[model samples]
Target: MVGLRVLTCGFAAAALSVAGCSATGTTGTTPSGRQATTSNPAPGSPSTASPADLARKQASAAYVGMWRDVAEAAKTSDWRSPILSRHATGDALSVISRSMYADHRNGLVAKGAPKTYPKAISADPSAGPTTVMISDCGDSTNWLKYRKDTGELADDTPGGRRAITAEVKKAAGGWKVARFAVEAVGSC
Candidate 1:
């Protein structure tokens, strides 16, 4: 009975694996005759990503780039850095500028860059998206504020992962972050 149960369980697991593969429309043959899986498209089908998918990718990239640019500018508290404008605009740009300006006023500078993992939550007009909403968990443990003159930590608090949401728009120059709100640390 034990041996029979083991065999039945193995068959059931194999059946589930096959079912999952079929559900995803993925099928290929490995050199060893085992099944290989690919994304979305079956063999010989067009693998081009849809317009909405492309927009999502572009918007996510822009959102992440904005964080990077802001971090770079924070290193010296350069609120006027042109790099900030490259990936951000409107409310997003204004927020970054204000934060950097405040940091400058406090004689503070950031020493490291925050890590961002941005995902596209939604895209308008599924066919050719003009706007995308992004959700992110931004980790800033390595990024910390420090005093510019003494090179010492600014406060007793430490940075942590936070939840972030943003809106990105398709502009003539490509995708740009229009607005973003970051929640408190540990919110992620």
Candidate 2:
């Protein structure tokens, strides 16, 4: 049950850009930290985002990118790569990294790969800007796995979606994934 929940390809990840909300800083951090300040200096009005929402979206996008890379690495049985170091740290890395290693040893690998799209995003309002607890939901239905040598299907998780809750922390350079919880969801 745990393995099935953890390993799924149906997740989407990318960068952040809202139609009205302009980005203030390079690392997804706003100086004020009270609200999402916009770079849109229009005469009439501007958009504002809750700091927690912004933080979660940014971190979730980063996680999807990192997980995608991790999937690609599985094709060649390469688990230890620099991408892991760049995007994530702590238990998040530990869980996925170890899982991939075991999968390789067991001769089971993902088949089609993970395809993710953001479904919902939210963050804890009580948390500060630098550190926010984020829960992200997405559709990963296209993600499936199979055996490497025998050409047999390994897992085709029901519904094909993934939901993750993560803690994203702002470092000196940019946002890094502190950790995350991955689970196979019923729907996107």
Candidate 3:
């Protein structure tokens, strides 16, 4: 069912670093707060965003961007692809790499055109690298599965909504996904 697809997307999301993102969709909110996805003040324009607000937004975008990229990588099984490696680490990486291998072996892959509307973005400033929680209206309406290398497309499926939590930490480089999880939700 759609619910399982949503969960699978989440699993891949953690693995590939993104599972939902649609540029055409409207805005959304989450329990943590909506500031994460709020419209950004134009660069160089005088703004009222506190330092914390700006940090939250940047972190949120990075986290959400991971899902978007992961979803797009459905057709590919190279879990170590540059994009996925940049966002995922630890168990998340293991899961995604293993799953992709399985998909390749079974000749199956998913195409979940995830359109994520991040409803909430919250971060703990005191935490190192900052811990962030992103709840989004995960709308994967064009979601589908396919027979890999065969181009056999399946039915159109939709992932209603999903709550994703990721613990992001600052490494020698930029932010990295230490751990993350996805859960199905009845509403955004």
Q: Which scores higher on lDDT, 2 or 3?
A: 2
Candidate 3 C-alpha error for residue 114, in Å: 0.7
Q: How close is candidate 2 to the true structure, as a TM-score?
A: 0.63
> Where is model 1 poorest over a 10-residue stretch in terms of lDDT?
1-10
Q: Return the clash pairs for model 3, or none.
A: 17-66, 17-67, 18-66, 18-67, 19-67, 21-114, 29-119, 30-119, 30-120
Model 2 misses residue 165 by how many Å?
Answer: 1.3
Q: Taking the tens digit of each residue's C-alpha lDDT, what string does model 3 give over 1-188?
A: 21123333333222212122222223667787764455654432226444444445555666666666566565565555667767666665566666666666767767656666653245555333255455555665566667777768644444555555565555556655556656654544
| Predicted structure 1, TM vs. truth | 0.75
State the lDDT of candidate 2 residue by residue for 1-188, as single tens digits.
11325643333333333222343432344677755534443322233555555565566566666667666666644567667656666666676677777877877766445655432243444354565454456454555556778866676544355566556666676666666666657633
TM-score of each: 0.75, 0.63, 0.63
Clashing pairs in 1: none
Ranking by TM-score: 1, 3, 2
In order, what lDDT does every prediction score?
0.72, 0.56, 0.54
Worst 10 residues of 3 by lDDT: 13-22
> How big is the positional error of residue 148 in model 3, measured in Å on the Cα after superposition?
1.5
Alpha carbon lDDT of residue 94, candidate 1? 80
